[model samples]
Target: MSESEAGRITIDTSRPHPARVYDWWLGGKDNYPVDEELARKILAADGTAVRGARANRRFMHRAVRTAAEAGIRQFLDIGTGIPTEPNLHQVAQGAAPESRVVYADNDPIVLRHAEALLKGSAEGSTDYVHADVRDPDTILRLAGESLDFGRPVALSLVALTHYLGDEDDVYGLIERYVARLAPGSHLILSQVTQDLSPEGVARAAELFRRSGTPFYPRTLTEFARFFDGLELLGPGVIPVYGWRPDPEDVAAQAEGVVPVYAGVARKP
Candidate 1:
């Protein structure tokens, strides 16, 4: 576990963390040698790994915009990884300046960089909660301070659930989080799946396991189950790069075979 003191989180550079490694992948400078080592190893094993990360970020941009355009003005993004450009609040507030966002993550590095996530449009509000995804109740309680549970909230779990194995009772965690939202709330998710590259993805998962970070890439059907009891949006459960691909992003279009599955659904 990392050390924490007086609201200043001290990170453990001795090991690799998911959020920091993800930061490295996004070309952020917050990662350590351990993180870079793991990232490089995964990149070496799966040529599409880095591209998959970038594609997921692009999907986040499009999905946030979609929710905003649909009149949703609140966001609760858990496992918010590390702050890459166009963070959730930035995208949401850009479209709707009054949009409120609450970001939750367990990583100390993310907490250290929480300041950037806090900067939202003057009219909007952004707050960070340092908590693990497993504790949905704490997240909901703390987030309640900023968001209104009586209104639709775009709950984002992008590129997060694959870390949770079946034993983790992943569905229960998701359901608990969703159950707190008012009707019309949305669930946005993206997870790595071996459907496209079984061997390579499994190898990467083992590497993560050895590094003490669990990675479980679910199948397409398993990934879709996350949206159970919710109304799925059209063009559902497709590759991250395939969802609302930008014509201007020629590379995203060319890389339509990204191994991550993503979808957005609304609570009935």
Candidate 2:
């Protein structure tokens, strides 16, 4: 919240936003009626929506913890949704008290809840950047104030890439961000995929498109392309729940299939 540029923030309740829709799926109360409507519609078409959201959250926690345990002390999380409990900062700082985190999101609602995200352990520092993921320069520049790019940092974009279509140069944007990181830095990502349930995923994509949000559900090979030059960690590019699952993730796997691909890689 402290890094936000001064301006009047506005919440557009007319159309559904991906972050708010995701919040609704996560059982958070920060979304509007339009967001809830879309979330319910997508859930009706794709029964795994809620489970996928939850699994993605777990994947993020596990990934951040892994990085923290590996001695990474700086984190940059883009497309950070609503202020969910045990957020990226909490998970990272929990593993390493001195972990520094910077969260970036374009949603006004997220900005309003930035104060909650800023509360980290006394040994660590947390900052929020009110910016879009497409503008990597702005985010990196502002986040640099708190994170040292000269050293290893963990960059996470969980359940976010699917919202950007091919026209957005998703891979190129990711490359730009990765190029700024030092060696040994980690890149954590989780994306919605159609490899598990093609029919349901297609229907869900259509629903999102009609609601004015562009959605792209990639196949396994396509999703794996995101880790091109990086070294993938163990359990490479598997289903969401299968990526270093904890007890919670183990139980979730028995519930249903979450057509999402998650992976963590290190810049060697």
Candidate 3:
């Protein structure tokens, strides 16, 4: 759909955005040339970006399913990328039809695809907020309308925190939400890291910077800091492929480093 299709958001075809580039990597047709160009550059720099994206996607899927099985009925997913099939709400609501989910993203392309994202299960609820993660207050306010903060809510920040540079108060922003969550609340995340492939990771970051979308690749410890004080789930913070993977999937990811670290933790 074109930007004009959604009068609420402005489309900037001039520059590449994280969501659009991510969409392009997933082989979606909703991205513009700018996004494709940057995605190609990142791919050239590190042939594993596409693989990393797929690994991250699988991590999100697994996390949502596990959360639903763990009795999490509400989800607040920030930096929710494009409306990929079997999206977060779809996976969660599939497991628990009464699930309620709220998606927030700063990208205009995501806003344009928000309508599709709302097609959740009949017994479930879905809402979208065009807000940035930097403004945790705005996300909390909007998401609260759809999710009950008094109860446990799974906050999914998959493949997103890396975009929040060191200059951004990402830790503080995350802590703000963690503090507000109830005891059973969970933090689900997967981020790009330089632990395995330092050279490839640096090259990908530089490519993103050249494309005007600077991405920071953190170390494993740095990623773990985001979940400080929380109880880590089994398998802990490891490569997305290292998470409790299906036997067949584990064989698929045994080749090389995925360049992504992930984990699901519960707020005490």
How many steric overlaps are in each model, in order? 0, 0, 0
Cα TM-score of candidate 3: 0.96
Model-by-model lDDT, in order? 0.89, 0.94, 0.89
Which scores better on lDDT, 1 or 3?
Answer: 1
lDDT of 3 by residue, 69-149 (tens): 889999999999998888999899989999999999988878878889999999999999888989888889878888899
TM for candidate 1 is 0.96
- Per-residue lDDT for 47-157 in model 2, tens only? 999999989998999999999988999999999999999899999989998999999999999998998999999999999999999999999999999999999999999
- Candidate 1 local lDDT, residue 234: 76
Error of 1 at 171 (Å): 0.8
Poorest lDDT segment (10 consecutive residues) of candidate 2: 1-10
User: Model 1, 1-268: lDDT tens per residue?
Assistant: 1235316766889999998888888898989999999999998887788888888888899999999999999999999988888999999999999999999999987887788889999999999899999999889999999999999999999999999987889998899999899998989999999998888898899999999998899999999999989999878999787787776445766754568999999999
How well does each candidate superpose onto the true structure, as a TM-score?
Answer: 0.96, 0.98, 0.96
Pairs of colliding residues, candidate 3? none
Instruction: Using lDDT as the measure, name the better of candidate 1 and candidate 2.
Output: 2
Candidate 3 yields a Cα-based lDDT of 0.89
